[model samples]
Target chain A: MTRLEIDHLYVPVAGRTILHDIGFTAEGGSLIGLVGPNGAGKSTLAKTIAGLLQPASGTIAVNGVALDTMDRRDAARKIAYLSQGDTVHWPLAVRATVTLGRAPHSGRFGTASPGDRRAVEAALHRADVLSLADRNIQQLSGGERARVLLARALAVEAPILIADEPVGALDPRHALNIIGLLREEAARGALVIAVLHDLALASRFCDRLLVMRDGRLAADGPPHDVLSPAGMEQHYAVAAHHGTHEAERFVIPWRTLNAADRKPNQEGETA
Target chain B: MNRLPAPATSRIGTAPLCLILLGILAGLMLASLTIGYVHIPPGRLVQAAFGMADPATTTIVQQLRMPRMILAALVGASLGGAGAVLQGLLHNPLAEPGTLGITGAASLGAVVALYFGLAATVPMSLPLCAMSGAAIATVILLVVARDSASTLTLILVGTGIGGIAIALTSLAMNLSPNPWAVSEIAMWLLGSVKDRTFSEVWLALPFVIVGLAALLAAAPSLDLLSLGEDTARSMGLNASRLRTMAIAGTSLAVGAGVAVSGSVGFVGLMMPHLVRPLVGQVPSRTVLPSIIGGGALVLASDIVVRLIAIGPELQLGVLTSLLGTPFFLYLVLHLRRQLP
Candidate 1:
C-alpha cells in the first residue's frame, strides 16, 4: 500500500496555469472520487499526480518518496493511471492487453513471470473480462473494451490507482459496476482515486469526495459535506436534491442554477 | 524439469515456429547459392566453402554468390526488424519506410551522391549520403508529425514527402550527362540485387547491424506503447524518448539498405504481417521472427530473380512491388473497416 501526497501542485500548459496550488493527500485503502465540470482540472490533477504530466511548481510523493526524484519504472510500480479515452492501438488479445499492465513489474525484455500471470488472471476476474480474454480487443464492444482496459490497470496492482473519468459515457449499470469494482480495489488496500462526473454515483461509492472548480479543490470531505445543496451550487453551478436510500446518501442535480441563484458578493449586490 | 506456468498473455509454441522459420531461411540461403544457373552441387558448394574444392569452383561459390547472399540476408533482416519496430513505435500498422517515403529519401540521397561524381571517387560516400538523407527525412517527419498527428495526417504527410523525393530523383535522372548514365540510373532505380559486390556489403553491414540493435532494444517498450501514448506514459515510459530511438534505428537500417539496393520496396511493410500470426502480436516476440521472416522473403526473391532470367533479369524490388502491392491493398481495405 502507498499514500499519494501532493503539495501546492501546479501544472502549466503553454503559458497559462491549468492547475494552481492544488494540494491533496490520499491514503491507501479508500475509493476517493474527484468531481468537477469540464475543464475543472480534475484530469490535470490526476495526470500530474500519476506523473503523466509533471507538476510545474510543487511536489508529489508516492509512499513518502518524491515523485520527481523517482525512476520512471519505480514511479510506475507505485501508481497505476487509467486515462479516460478510447484507445486500443493494435488488435491485441484481451489477455495480452491486460498483461501489458505488468510492464513495470516485468524486466526490460517483458518476460512473463508466474506472479505476473496470477495478477493478470486476478485482474481479469475482478474487471469481469475473463470471458473475453481470448478475443481481440477490437472485436469487443465499447463497454467490454473499457472493462478490458480497466482490467489492464488492475493488473498493474499498484498501490495507488488514479483513473480519470473511468465511467464517462458508460451506461448506468456498467458505471455503477466500475465504481463498485474500485470500491473493492480499495478494500484490497489500493488507494483508488477515480474522477467522476455523476454526482449520485460519486456520492454512492466514493468514501471521500474532492470537488474541483477552476483548478482548485473547491471542497473536500465526505460525500454528504461536499455534495450539499450550497456546495453543489457554489462549485458545480447546479442545485442538487439530497436523498437517502438504503442507509446511503445520493444527490441528484435538479437544474442548472440561473443568474438569479448566484450568491451575491458582500461588497456589492448588482442584481 | 524446467517449465513456466501458463503464458501471461501470448499463446504457447512460438519458439518452435521461430526455429522452423530459421531452418527455412538457412535452406533458402543454400538454395540461393546452389540453385542458380551456375549449377554448383551442394556437396561441391560445401567443399568450396571449406576450401577443399578446385580454385575455379571455389571462386564461383565463395567469391561470387556468397557475398551477394549475405548482403540480401542483411537487407532483408534489417527491413523486417525495422518494419516491426516502426509499427509498434508509432502504433500505426501502416507505418513502413517505403510507404512513408523514407525509401524515396534514401533513393534521392544515393542518386544525389552519384550525380555529384562522389561514388566514383569514394565508394563509402554513397551510403553516407544515403544515411544523411534518411536522417534528414526522419527529422523532418518527426517535426511534421507532432506526437498527436492523426493516422490520416501521418499517411498524407508520408505521401507528400515521398512524392517530392521521387520527383526530385526523376529530375536528377533526367538531367544526367549521358544516356548510359540515364540507363544505369533507371536500372538502379528499379532496385536490383544483380552485380552486387562484396565491397558494398562491407560498407552497409555496420550501420544496418547498429540499426537492428536499436530496434531490438526498444521492443519491450513498444508493447507498452501499443496501449496509446497517454497510457504508455502512465506506465513510466517517455513516449518522445522511445520515438527518437525508433526513428534513429529506422534511419540506420533503411538508410544502409537503400544505400546498397537503391530503395527495395515493401519488405519492411510486409514482413511483420507474415510473422505476426505465428508469434502473436506482442512487439518484443515478433521482432526476431520478423527479422528472420524478412531475410527469408528477400532471399527467396533474389532466387526468383535468378530463375526468371531473360537477359538483364527482373530486379528484386520489382518482384517485391508486384507481390507487395496486393498485400498493401488488402491491408488498406481491412484498415478501412477498422479506422473511424
Candidate 2:
C-alpha cells in the first residue's frame, strides 16, 4: 500500500535547473518507465525522487510520510535506489556486497540477524547469482556484476525500487531477464521505476510510461498512448514508424530532419 | 572457484573477533615480558612480576624490562589501530602515519621542544607539542584533499607535507647549540623502547585509548564508505563527519606514539592489509585484530632488534623498515598484476 509521490519537483545543480516542475506518482504493484533523449534530465529526475538529491522547491513523500520528515534509515527502508554506473573499490565477495544492502536494517554495530541472512539468500536467488555467491565482485563479468548490484538492491526489500539504467551494460538476453525481474517485483506489490534508453523494450515491458522533454514531463499515460509517433517526433524530433507484430507494438525511429523540414507543411506544399 | 575457506563461523562478527583479539593481546603481553636481553626464565619473570624475586633480579626485571616491554606493546597497538583508520579514511592501502606526514610532524615538534630546552624543564611538553603538530598536519592534509579528490591526490599531498616536516626536523637538529640535543634527536628518530619509564607509558596511554575508542566507533561507517561516498551517504552516513573523526583520532594516537617512541614505521600500514581478508573485509571487524596484530608485530621486531646486533642495539624503526620494504614492493607488484 506504499506510494511514492513527487509533487512539482524542481531540481537544480550548481545554479542551473536540471529538472523543472516535474511530478509523478508510483503506486505499489506498478512498473513505470522513464524514457527521454540525452540531456533530458531523466537521471536527474530519478536521483531526486530517490532522495539522492534535494529538489530545489518541492515535496517528495513515501506512503504519505514526507521524505524530509523521515530519518535516513526509515526512508531507505521504503525506497531502494540503484545508480546508473556503480563501482566498488574493495574486492568483496558477492554475498558480502549483498549483505551491505541490509545496512538500514542492521543497527550501528552491523551484525546481521538470522532474518537478515535469510533476506540476503532470497535476494541472491531472485537475481540468479546463488551459484556465484562466493565469487569476488571484481572478477565477475559486466553482466554478472550488474546482476550482483541488482541483487544488492533487491536485498533491501524496500517497497519502492528505483534503478537508473540498470540494464544498460547487460547483453540482450540479460537485459530482458532484468526487465522480467523488475516486472516480477512489481507483481509482488513493489513500485518499480526504471530509466531506460531502449524505447522498444520500454514499450514492451512497462505497464506505464513517463516521457520527458528538456526537463519537463511531455507525456504520462499507458505506454500505448504516450509512445505514439507524434509524441516521439515532438519530444525527440525524429521520424518514427509503429507496427504491430505478434500482438506487440514496435516503434522504430528512422531519421532526424533539417530545420527547414521541421516547419509546418502547407496543404499544397510538395516535398 | 576455490572458495576462500569459509571465514570460520566463530569469527563471523565484530564482538567475538574483538574478544579473541583481547585474549591474544594478553598472551602476547606475557610473552613479551619473558623475552629480552637477559632471558629471565618464565618462572623467574612471574616471581619477579609478583614482587617475590631476589633484589638484584627484581631491579633488572621489574624496574627496567617490564616497563619497556609494555611500552613497546602499547606503541605497537596505537600505531596499528591508527594506521588502519587512516587507510580506511583515505580509501588507500598505502596510507600510514609516517607516509601521511603525522610522524614527521611529530618528529619536528619533539625537536622544537628540545631546541627550546623545554624537555629538561617539562617532560610532558614534548609529547603535547608532538600531538599538536600531528593534529595540525592531519588537518592540513584533510583541507587540501577535499571530499571529492581521488586517493592518489591525497597521498601525493601527504607526501609533500611529510617531506617538508622532515626537512624542518633535520634543520632544527643541526642548528641546536647542545650536542646532547643533537644526539638525543638522532636516537629518537631511530625509534626505541629502551630506557623508557612507566611515567612515559602513562603519558601516552590517554591519547592512545581515546583515539582507539574514536576509531572503533567509526568502524561501521568505514565499512559503508568502502562502497564509495555516494552509496555511503544514501545509506544515512555523513561521509565528511566520519572522515574528520577518523583523521583526528589517527593523529592523536600516532602523535602520542611518535612522542614516546620516535617514528616507528610499518605497523599501521601492514597490519590491516594482512588481517582484512581474515575478517571478511569488514573494516569494523578488522580494527581490534589490527591492534593486537600490530602490537605483536612490533614487540616481536623489538625483541629481534635486541637479539640480532653484536655490539650496539639496532633501532626498532630500522628493523621494521628492513623487513617492510620488500613486502611493500611485493604488494605493489601484486596490485599492478591485478589491475586491468
Candidate 3:
C-alpha cells in the first residue's frame, strides 16, 4: 500500500506557471479520477507526479518518503506511470512491451528473473491481454493497444499507478472497461489515478474526483458533490441537468451558461 | 526483451543465426587474405600467415594483407555497431553514425594533420588528432542537439556541423603547399584500407573494443528508449546517462575507424538495416549480426575493388556507395508503408 501526497505543488514550463499550489493526497485502495477542462494542467500534474517533470515548488511524497530523496530506480519500483495514447515508440510485441515494465526489478543489464516473468504474466491476465501478447503493438486496435500499455504498467506491480488520459480515444465500452480495470487496481491496494474526460464515466466508476480548472484544484470530493450544477457552472461555465435514481447520480450537460444568466430565482436569495 | 517470446519470433533464439554470421565473417576474412592480385594457395596462405613461408610470401601475407584485412574488419564492425547505437538512441531509422558529424569531424582532423605534416612526423598523431576531433564533435552535438529537440532538429544540426567541417577541409586543401599534397588529400577523402600497418590496427583496436563494450552495456537502456522517452524515464532510465554512453561509444568507434581507414562510408549505415530482417528491429539483437555483416561487406567490397582495378585500386568508400545507395533506396521504397 502507498500514500501519494502532492502538497502545494507548483509547476512551471517556459517561464509560465502551469500548475499552481495544487495539492492532493491519495491513499491506497481507491480510484482517483483527475478531471479538468482543456489546458487545465491535468496532464502537467500527472507528468509531474510520475517524475517525468520536476515541480517548481513543493514536494511529492510516496509512503512518507520524499520523491526528491529517492533514487530514480527506487521510485520507479514504487510508482508506475503510463503516458497517454500511443506512447509506445517501437512496434514491440505486446508481451515484450509488458515485460519492459520489469526494468527496475531486473538485475544488471536487465536480465529478467522468474519473478519478473510471473509479474508480466499476471499483468497480461489482469489486463485481459494474454491473447494479444504475441501480436504486434502497432497492429492491434487502439483499445487493444491501450490495454497492452495498461498491462505494461500493471506488470510493474507498483503501489501507485498514474495514467494520463489512458482512455482519451477509447470508445465508450472500451473506456468503461479501462475505468473498471483501474477500479480493480485500486481494489487490489494500488493507488490508481487516471485523468478522465468523461464525466459520466468518472461519476460511475471513480471513488473520488479531483477537478482542476486553470491550474487550481477547483473541486475535490465524492462525484455527487463535485458534479453539482453550481459546481459545474462555476468551473466549467455550463448548465447541467442532474438527477439521482436509486443509488446512482448522473450529470448531463444541457447548455452553456453565461455569468449574468447563471443565477436563477436565487436572485432573491442573494438579498 | 528476453523475458517473453517476442511476436517477432524469427529472431527469438538468435545464437545459431549469429554464429552462422560469425562463420561467414571468418570465411570472408580468409578470402580477403587469399584472393588478390597475387593469389596465395590455401596451404601456402597458412604458411604465410604463420610466418613459415618464403620471405616474399610472408611479407605479402603478414605485413601487407594482414593489416589491411584486420583494419577493414574492425572498421566495418565499429561503424555497424555505432550505427545501431545511434538509431536506437534517437529512434530514427535514418540515424547513421556520420549523421552526427563524427566522421566529418574526424576527416577534418586528419586533413589538418596531413596539411601540417603532423601525420608524417608522428606515427600516433593522425589517430590522436582524429579521435580528438571526434570527441569535440560529440561534445558539441550533446551540448546543442541532445536537448529534447525533435529528431529532425537533431539531424539538421548535425548536418550543419558536418557541412561546416567539410567546407573547412576543402578550404584547407585549396590552400595546400603543392599539387601532390592536394591530390593526396583528394584520394584520401575517397577512403581506402590500402597500405595500412599492424601498428595502426593496434592503435584503433582499443577504442573500438571500448566503444563496443559501452554500447553493449547500454543495450537495456536502448531497449527502454525504444519505448519512447517519457516511459523510459518513468522506468527509471537516466536520459543523460543513456545519451552520454551512446555518444561516447559512437565517437570512439567511428573516430577510431576513420583514423585507421581514411573514411569508409555506408558500411555502418547499411549493415544494421540489412541485418534487421534477420534479427528483428530490436537494437540489442542487431549489434552482433550487424557487426559480422559489416565486416563481411567490407571484405566483399575490398575483394571486388581489388579484382576489378587494373591500375589504381578503387576506393573502398566509393565501392560501398555504389553498392549501398541503390540498396538503401530499395529498402526505403519497400519499407515506405511500414516506416514511422
Which one wins on lDDT?
1
lDDT per residue as tens, model 1, B225-321: 7787778888878778787788888888888988888867899889887766555566667788888888899999999988986897889999999
Please list all clashing residue pairs in model 2, or write none if there are none: none
Model 1 per-residue lDDT at A211? 84
lDDT by residue (A12-34, candidate 2, tens digit) is: 97799988898888799999999
Better of 1 and 2 by TM-score: 1
- In Å, residue A17's CA in model 2 sits off its true spot by 4.4
> Per-prediction DockQ scores?
0.47, 0.32, 0.45
Clashing pairs in 3: none
Residue-wise C-alpha lDDT for candidate 3, range B242-338, written one tens digit per residue: 8888777877878888888877776767887776655656666777777778888888888789999568789998888787768656755655666
Per-residue lDDT of A162-190 in model 3, one digit per residue for the tens? Answer: 99998899998888888889999999999
Clashes of each: 0, 0, 0
For each model in turn, which proportion of the native inter-chain contacts is also found? Answer: 0.62, 0.30, 0.57
Question: Would you list the rank order by TM-score, best first?
Answer: 1, 3, 2
